[model samples]
Target: MPDEHDQDEEPELELTSALVPFFVITNGRALPSDQQYERTALVTALKGTSAAARTLSPEAQAIVDLVAHGFLSVAEVAGHTHLPLGIVRILLAQLEESGLVLVRKPVPRAEPTDRELLGDVLAGLKSKFGA
Candidate 1:
Protein backbone atom coordinates (compact mmCIF):
# COMPACT_ATOMS: atom_id res chain seq x y z
CA MET A 1 0.00 0.00 0.00
CA PRO A 2 1.24 3.53 -0.82
CA ASP A 3 2.08 5.61 2.20
CA GLU A 4 -0.31 8.57 2.91
CA HIS A 5 2.73 10.79 3.44
CA ASP A 6 4.04 9.89 0.00
CA GLN A 7 0.71 10.79 -1.61
CA ASP A 8 0.72 14.14 0.23
CA GLU A 9 4.25 14.97 -0.88
CA GLU A 10 4.37 17.48 -3.70
CA PRO A 11 5.45 16.04 -7.03
CA GLU A 12 9.10 16.59 -7.74
CA LEU A 13 9.55 19.59 -9.96
CA GLU A 14 11.09 18.96 -13.31
CA LEU A 15 14.33 20.80 -13.89
CA THR A 16 14.45 23.31 -16.72
CA SER A 17 16.93 25.77 -18.08
CA ALA A 18 16.77 29.08 -16.30
CA LEU A 19 15.45 32.05 -18.21
CA VAL A 20 18.12 34.41 -19.48
CA PRO A 21 17.40 38.08 -19.14
CA PHE A 22 17.00 40.02 -22.37
CA PHE A 23 19.66 42.54 -21.39
CA VAL A 24 22.19 39.80 -20.98
CA ILE A 25 21.22 38.26 -24.28
CA THR A 26 21.81 41.51 -26.10
CA ASN A 27 24.88 42.43 -24.04
CA GLY A 28 22.94 45.28 -22.40
CA ARG A 29 22.27 47.02 -25.69
CA ALA A 30 18.72 47.86 -26.65
CA LEU A 31 19.41 48.05 -30.38
CA PRO A 32 21.86 46.55 -32.80
CA SER A 33 25.22 48.28 -32.77
CA ASP A 34 25.53 49.10 -36.42
CA GLN A 35 22.86 48.83 -39.12
CA GLN A 36 19.23 49.06 -38.09
CA TYR A 37 17.29 45.97 -39.16
CA GLU A 38 13.76 46.59 -40.30
CA ARG A 39 11.23 44.01 -39.23
CA THR A 40 10.59 43.31 -42.90
CA ALA A 41 14.23 42.80 -43.77
CA LEU A 42 14.91 39.23 -44.87
CA VAL A 43 17.63 37.17 -43.20
CA THR A 44 19.28 33.93 -44.24
CA ALA A 45 22.29 31.90 -43.22
CA LEU A 46 25.10 32.25 -45.65
CA LYS A 47 26.34 29.16 -47.42
CA GLY A 48 29.01 27.34 -45.39
CA THR A 49 28.25 29.43 -42.29
CA SER A 50 26.61 26.86 -40.07
CA ALA A 51 30.01 26.02 -38.60
CA ALA A 52 30.33 29.50 -37.20
CA ALA A 53 27.01 29.16 -35.47
CA ARG A 54 28.55 26.71 -33.02
CA THR A 55 30.50 29.56 -31.45
CA LEU A 56 27.38 31.63 -30.75
CA SER A 57 24.87 31.53 -27.93
CA PRO A 58 22.00 29.08 -28.13
CA GLU A 59 19.65 31.86 -29.12
CA ALA A 60 21.97 32.97 -31.87
CA GLN A 61 22.38 29.41 -33.03
CA ALA A 62 18.64 29.04 -33.15
CA ILE A 63 18.42 32.10 -35.34
CA VAL A 64 21.05 30.71 -37.66
CA ASP A 65 19.28 27.39 -37.89
CA LEU A 66 15.94 29.01 -38.57
CA VAL A 67 17.35 30.96 -41.47
CA ALA A 68 19.59 28.23 -42.77
CA HIS A 69 16.92 26.60 -44.89
CA GLY A 70 15.50 29.77 -46.39
CA PHE A 71 14.96 33.46 -45.97
CA LEU A 72 12.83 34.80 -43.11
CA SER A 73 11.94 38.33 -42.15
CA VAL A 74 13.14 39.69 -38.83
CA ALA A 75 9.62 39.66 -37.46
CA GLU A 76 9.18 36.00 -38.36
CA VAL A 77 12.40 35.04 -36.65
CA ALA A 78 11.33 36.80 -33.46
CA GLY A 79 7.98 35.05 -33.54
CA HIS A 80 9.49 31.61 -34.19
CA THR A 81 12.12 32.00 -31.50
CA HIS A 82 9.77 33.59 -29.02
CA LEU A 83 12.35 36.32 -28.55
CA PRO A 84 11.78 40.03 -28.49
CA LEU A 85 12.14 41.94 -31.74
CA GLY A 86 15.01 43.97 -30.31
CA ILE A 87 16.88 40.88 -29.25
CA VAL A 88 16.39 39.28 -32.65
CA ARG A 89 17.74 42.36 -34.32
CA ILE A 90 20.77 42.43 -32.03
CA LEU A 91 21.53 38.76 -32.60
CA LEU A 92 21.02 39.07 -36.33
CA ALA A 93 23.35 42.05 -36.44
CA GLN A 94 26.01 40.03 -34.69
CA LEU A 95 25.49 37.06 -36.98
CA GLU A 96 25.69 39.32 -40.01
CA GLU A 97 28.86 40.90 -38.71
CA SER A 98 30.38 37.49 -38.15
CA GLY A 99 29.50 36.46 -41.73
CA LEU A 100 27.19 33.76 -40.50
CA VAL A 101 24.08 35.22 -42.07
CA LEU A 102 22.99 37.61 -44.77
CA VAL A 103 20.50 40.37 -44.10
CA ARG A 104 18.79 41.66 -47.20
CA LYS A 105 17.00 44.95 -47.17
CA PRO A 106 13.32 44.67 -47.88
CA VAL A 107 12.54 45.21 -51.52
CA PRO A 108 11.40 48.70 -52.35
CA ARG A 109 7.79 49.04 -53.38
CA ALA A 110 7.21 49.34 -57.12
CA GLU A 111 5.82 52.52 -58.54
CA PRO A 112 2.05 52.67 -58.92
CA THR A 113 0.78 50.24 -61.51
CA ASP A 114 0.49 51.58 -65.06
CA ARG A 115 -2.87 50.36 -66.29
CA GLU A 116 -1.77 51.02 -69.86
CA LEU A 117 1.22 48.68 -69.53
CA LEU A 118 -0.95 45.96 -67.95
CA GLY A 119 -3.47 46.16 -70.78
CA ASP A 120 -0.73 45.86 -73.39
CA VAL A 121 0.78 42.83 -71.67
CA LEU A 122 -2.61 41.19 -71.33
CA ALA A 123 -3.33 41.72 -75.03
CA GLY A 124 0.04 40.20 -76.01
CA LEU A 125 -0.48 37.17 -73.76
CA LYS A 126 -3.95 36.58 -75.15
CA SER A 127 -2.71 36.79 -78.76
CA LYS A 128 0.21 34.41 -78.05
CA PHE A 129 -1.95 31.89 -76.21
CA GLY A 130 -4.97 32.26 -78.57
CA ALA A 131 -7.17 32.54 -75.46
Candidate 2:
Protein backbone atom coordinates (compact mmCIF):
# COMPACT_ATOMS: atom_id res chain seq x y z
CA MET A 1 0.00 0.00 0.00
CA PRO A 2 2.97 2.34 0.44
CA ASP A 3 4.96 4.10 -2.27
CA GLU A 4 8.79 4.25 -2.54
CA HIS A 5 8.85 7.65 -0.80
CA ASP A 6 6.85 6.24 2.12
CA GLN A 7 9.25 3.33 2.44
CA ASP A 8 12.19 5.71 2.71
CA GLU A 9 10.47 7.53 5.58
CA GLU A 10 10.05 4.35 7.62
CA PRO A 11 13.60 4.28 8.99
CA GLU A 12 13.43 7.81 10.39
CA LEU A 13 10.14 7.05 12.12
CA GLU A 14 11.89 4.37 14.12
CA LEU A 15 14.17 6.84 15.94
CA THR A 16 12.67 10.34 15.79
CA SER A 17 9.79 11.50 17.89
CA ALA A 18 7.15 13.99 16.80
CA LEU A 19 7.75 16.18 19.82
CA VAL A 20 9.68 19.24 18.82
CA PRO A 21 13.18 19.36 20.29
CA PHE A 22 12.62 22.31 22.61
CA PHE A 23 10.17 24.99 23.63
CA VAL A 24 10.02 28.03 25.83
CA ILE A 25 7.14 26.92 28.04
CA THR A 26 6.47 30.41 29.42
CA ASN A 27 6.55 32.13 26.05
CA GLY A 28 4.79 29.26 24.27
CA ARG A 29 7.51 29.28 21.66
CA ALA A 30 9.42 26.41 20.09
CA LEU A 31 13.10 26.88 20.91
CA PRO A 32 14.53 23.72 19.44
CA SER A 33 17.69 25.39 18.32
CA ASP A 34 20.23 22.82 19.50
CA GLN A 35 20.39 19.11 18.85
CA GLN A 36 22.79 18.84 21.78
CA TYR A 37 19.96 19.40 24.27
CA GLU A 38 18.23 16.25 23.11
CA ARG A 39 21.47 14.38 23.43
CA THR A 40 22.05 15.80 26.91
CA ALA A 41 18.53 15.00 28.12
CA LEU A 42 18.61 11.46 26.80
CA VAL A 43 21.96 10.94 28.47
CA THR A 44 20.48 12.14 31.75
CA ALA A 45 17.58 9.70 31.42
CA LEU A 46 19.91 6.80 30.79
CA LYS A 47 22.06 7.64 33.80
CA GLY A 48 19.04 7.73 36.07
CA THR A 49 18.57 3.97 35.68
CA SER A 50 22.21 3.00 35.93
CA ALA A 51 22.96 2.88 39.67
CA ALA A 52 24.41 -0.58 39.12
CA ALA A 53 27.21 0.99 37.11
CA ARG A 54 28.68 2.42 40.31
CA THR A 55 29.28 -1.11 41.58
CA LEU A 56 31.83 -1.71 38.88
CA SER A 57 35.50 -1.29 39.70
CA PRO A 58 36.50 2.31 39.12
CA GLU A 59 38.78 1.52 36.19
CA ALA A 60 36.21 -0.75 34.57
CA GLN A 61 33.51 1.85 35.02
CA ALA A 62 35.79 4.42 33.47
CA ILE A 63 36.34 2.16 30.50
CA VAL A 64 32.61 1.60 30.05
CA ASP A 65 31.91 5.31 30.20
CA LEU A 66 34.62 6.16 27.71
CA VAL A 67 33.64 3.68 25.03
CA ALA A 68 29.91 4.32 25.28
CA HIS A 69 30.13 7.93 24.14
CA GLY A 70 30.76 9.04 20.56
CA PHE A 71 34.43 8.47 21.20
CA LEU A 72 34.02 5.09 19.56
CA SER A 73 37.56 3.98 19.00
CA VAL A 74 40.17 2.20 21.14
CA ALA A 75 42.75 4.74 20.05
CA GLU A 76 40.69 7.57 21.52
CA VAL A 77 40.60 5.86 24.88
CA ALA A 78 44.35 5.43 24.80
CA GLY A 79 44.90 9.05 23.88
CA HIS A 80 42.51 10.35 26.50
CA THR A 81 43.66 8.11 29.31
CA HIS A 82 47.34 8.49 28.40
CA LEU A 83 47.68 4.73 28.60
CA PRO A 84 49.61 2.69 26.13
CA LEU A 85 47.52 1.73 23.13
CA GLY A 86 48.15 -1.97 23.68
CA ILE A 87 47.14 -1.80 27.32
CA VAL A 88 43.96 0.11 26.61
CA ARG A 89 42.98 -2.27 23.81
CA ILE A 90 43.74 -5.29 25.97
CA LEU A 91 41.60 -3.97 28.78
CA LEU A 92 38.81 -3.19 26.34
CA ALA A 93 38.94 -6.78 25.07
CA GLN A 94 38.79 -8.06 28.62
CA LEU A 95 35.85 -5.81 29.39
CA GLU A 96 34.06 -7.10 26.31
CA GLU A 97 34.70 -10.66 27.38
CA SER A 98 33.40 -9.88 30.85
CA GLY A 99 30.25 -8.26 29.52
CA LEU A 100 31.32 -4.87 30.83
CA VAL A 101 32.17 -3.10 27.61
CA LEU A 102 31.75 -3.28 23.85
CA VAL A 103 33.13 -1.81 20.68
CA ARG A 104 30.50 0.35 19.05
CA LYS A 105 30.37 1.02 15.32
CA PRO A 106 32.83 3.57 13.94
CA VAL A 107 30.19 6.16 13.14
CA PRO A 108 27.70 7.33 15.74
CA ARG A 109 24.28 6.82 14.22
CA ALA A 110 20.89 8.32 15.08
CA GLU A 111 19.94 5.95 17.88
CA PRO A 112 21.89 4.62 20.82
CA THR A 113 21.22 1.91 23.36
CA ASP A 114 20.46 3.03 26.94
CA ARG A 115 23.90 2.01 28.09
CA GLU A 116 25.49 4.03 25.34
CA LEU A 117 23.65 7.16 26.37
CA LEU A 118 24.62 6.86 30.02
CA GLY A 119 28.19 6.06 29.11
CA ASP A 120 28.34 9.09 26.87
CA VAL A 121 27.36 11.48 29.64
CA LEU A 122 29.82 9.99 32.08
CA ALA A 123 32.55 10.02 29.47
CA GLY A 124 31.86 13.66 28.83
CA LEU A 125 32.48 14.31 32.53
CA LYS A 126 35.48 12.22 33.47
CA SER A 127 36.97 15.21 35.26
CA LYS A 128 36.17 18.81 35.86
CA PHE A 129 39.06 20.01 33.73
CA GLY A 130 38.10 17.80 30.81
CA ALA A 131 34.40 18.54 30.95
Candidate 3:
Protein backbone atom coordinates (compact mmCIF):
# COMPACT_ATOMS: atom_id res chain seq x y z
CA MET A 1 0.00 0.00 0.00
CA PRO A 2 1.17 3.54 -0.68
CA ASP A 3 2.28 5.52 2.35
CA GLU A 4 0.21 8.61 3.39
CA HIS A 5 3.04 10.90 2.19
CA ASP A 6 3.08 9.23 -1.23
CA GLN A 7 -0.67 9.68 -1.65
CA ASP A 8 -0.51 13.34 -0.66
CA GLU A 9 2.37 14.05 -3.02
CA GLU A 10 0.72 12.42 -6.04
CA PRO A 11 -1.94 15.10 -6.52
CA GLU A 12 0.60 17.90 -6.20
CA LEU A 13 2.77 16.30 -8.83
CA GLU A 14 -0.20 15.86 -11.13
CA LEU A 15 -1.17 19.52 -10.76
CA THR A 16 2.36 20.72 -11.58
CA SER A 17 2.52 18.46 -14.64
CA ALA A 18 -0.86 19.75 -15.77
CA LEU A 19 0.36 23.35 -15.63
CA VAL A 20 3.41 22.63 -17.75
CA PRO A 21 1.62 22.82 -21.09
CA PHE A 22 0.15 26.23 -20.28
CA PHE A 23 3.56 27.54 -19.38
CA VAL A 24 4.99 26.25 -22.62
CA ILE A 25 2.25 27.85 -24.68
CA THR A 26 2.59 31.28 -23.08
CA ASN A 27 6.27 31.57 -22.35
CA GLY A 28 8.29 33.96 -24.53
CA ARG A 29 5.14 34.87 -26.44
CA ALA A 30 4.02 38.40 -27.13
CA LEU A 31 0.49 39.52 -26.40
CA PRO A 32 -1.74 38.81 -29.38
CA SER A 33 -1.80 41.72 -31.76
CA ASP A 34 -5.54 41.95 -31.67
CA GLN A 35 -6.77 43.98 -28.73
CA GLN A 36 -10.44 43.18 -29.26
CA TYR A 37 -10.76 40.44 -26.67
CA GLU A 38 -11.53 42.40 -23.54
CA ARG A 39 -11.37 40.68 -20.16
CA THR A 40 -15.18 40.69 -19.95
CA ALA A 41 -15.69 39.31 -23.45
CA LEU A 42 -17.52 36.01 -23.43
CA VAL A 43 -15.86 33.05 -25.11
CA THR A 44 -17.50 29.85 -26.35
CA ALA A 45 -15.97 26.85 -28.01
CA LEU A 46 -16.82 25.83 -31.54
CA LYS A 47 -14.85 22.60 -30.92
CA GLY A 48 -16.54 19.78 -32.79
CA THR A 49 -18.30 22.24 -35.00
CA SER A 50 -15.29 24.22 -36.08
CA ALA A 51 -12.92 22.27 -38.25
CA ALA A 52 -10.05 24.45 -37.11
CA ALA A 53 -10.23 23.24 -33.51
CA ARG A 54 -8.97 19.83 -34.66
CA THR A 55 -5.48 21.30 -34.92
CA LEU A 56 -5.49 23.16 -31.60
CA SER A 57 -2.43 23.12 -29.36
CA PRO A 58 -2.88 21.39 -26.01
CA GLU A 59 -3.38 24.65 -24.17
CA ALA A 60 -6.12 25.70 -26.58
CA GLN A 61 -7.78 22.31 -26.30
CA ALA A 62 -7.98 22.68 -22.54
CA ILE A 63 -9.71 26.05 -23.00
CA VAL A 64 -12.14 24.57 -25.53
CA ASP A 65 -13.12 21.85 -23.07
CA LEU A 66 -13.77 24.38 -20.33
CA VAL A 67 -16.09 26.39 -22.56
CA ALA A 68 -17.85 23.28 -23.84
CA HIS A 69 -20.42 23.58 -21.05
CA GLY A 70 -21.23 27.25 -21.69
CA PHE A 71 -19.71 30.62 -22.48
CA LEU A 72 -17.22 32.15 -20.04
CA SER A 73 -15.66 35.58 -19.78
CA VAL A 74 -12.01 35.93 -20.72
CA ALA A 75 -11.11 36.75 -17.11
CA GLU A 76 -12.93 33.66 -15.88
CA VAL A 77 -11.03 31.53 -18.35
CA ALA A 78 -7.72 32.95 -17.09
CA GLY A 79 -8.73 32.35 -13.46
CA HIS A 80 -9.94 28.79 -14.05
CA THR A 81 -6.98 27.84 -16.23
CA HIS A 82 -4.50 29.45 -13.81
CA LEU A 83 -2.97 31.39 -16.70
CA PRO A 84 -2.09 35.06 -16.56
CA LEU A 85 -4.63 37.39 -18.16
CA GLY A 86 -2.21 38.35 -20.92
CA ILE A 87 -1.49 34.72 -21.70
CA VAL A 88 -5.15 33.84 -21.75
CA ARG A 89 -5.78 36.73 -24.11
CA ILE A 90 -3.07 35.49 -26.44
CA LEU A 91 -4.46 31.97 -26.44
CA LEU A 92 -7.96 33.23 -27.06
CA ALA A 93 -6.79 35.37 -29.96
CA GLN A 94 -5.16 32.35 -31.58
CA LEU A 95 -8.25 30.20 -31.10
CA GLU A 96 -10.44 32.92 -32.51
CA GLU A 97 -8.16 33.38 -35.48
CA SER A 98 -8.56 29.70 -36.28
CA GLY A 99 -12.36 29.89 -35.82
CA LEU A 100 -12.18 27.52 -32.86
CA VAL A 101 -13.76 29.94 -30.43
CA LEU A 102 -16.28 32.77 -30.57
CA VAL A 103 -15.45 35.86 -28.53
CA ARG A 104 -18.45 38.12 -27.86
CA LYS A 105 -17.70 41.60 -26.68
CA PRO A 106 -19.40 42.60 -23.48
CA VAL A 107 -22.43 44.86 -23.86
CA PRO A 108 -21.84 48.32 -22.47
CA ARG A 109 -24.26 49.04 -19.66
CA ALA A 110 -25.83 52.49 -19.65
CA GLU A 111 -25.48 54.38 -16.43
CA PRO A 112 -28.67 55.83 -15.03
CA THR A 113 -28.80 59.63 -14.91
CA ASP A 114 -28.44 61.13 -11.44
CA ARG A 115 -31.95 62.54 -11.62
CA GLU A 116 -33.42 59.18 -12.59
CA LEU A 117 -31.53 57.38 -9.82
CA LEU A 118 -32.58 59.90 -7.21
CA GLY A 119 -36.19 59.60 -8.29
CA ASP A 120 -36.16 55.87 -7.78
CA VAL A 121 -34.43 56.22 -4.43
CA LEU A 122 -37.02 58.76 -3.29
CA ALA A 123 -39.85 56.45 -4.29
CA GLY A 124 -38.30 53.58 -2.36
CA LEU A 125 -37.88 55.73 0.77
CA LYS A 126 -41.47 57.00 0.58
CA SER A 127 -42.81 53.45 0.26
CA LYS A 128 -40.85 52.31 3.31
CA PHE A 129 -41.19 55.37 5.58
CA GLY A 130 -44.37 57.04 4.26
CA ALA A 131 -44.46 60.16 2.02
List per-prediction Cα lDDT, in the order shown: 0.85, 0.48, 0.79
Over 5-96, each residue of candidate 3 has an lDDT whose tens digit, in order, gives 67654464445355356457865556875457788999998757546566667677889888987999999998998888888888888778
Instruction: Provide backbone clash counts, one per model.
Output: 0, 0, 0
lDDT of 1 by residue, 65-107 (tens): 9999999999999999999888899898888889999999987
Candidate with the greatest lDDT versus the true structure: 1
Kindly list the per-residue Cα lDDT of model 2 for residues 1-131, writing each as its tens digit: 45456656446455564343212111232233233222212211122324656665454466667655543455556666565554455555445555655454343457756998888788878765585
Model 2 superposed RMSD (Cα): 22.5
Order the candidates by TM-score, highest first.
Answer: 1, 3, 2
**Candidate 3 stretches greater than 4 Å from native:** 1-23, 27-29, 33-35, 47-51, 111-131
The best-first sequence of candidates by lDDT reads: 1, 3, 2
Return the TM-score for candidate 3, rounded to 2 decimals: 0.59
lDDT of 3: 0.79
Evaluated against the true structure, the overall lDDT of model 1 is 0.85
Q: Point out the worst 10-residue segment of candidate 2 by lDDT.
A: 36-45
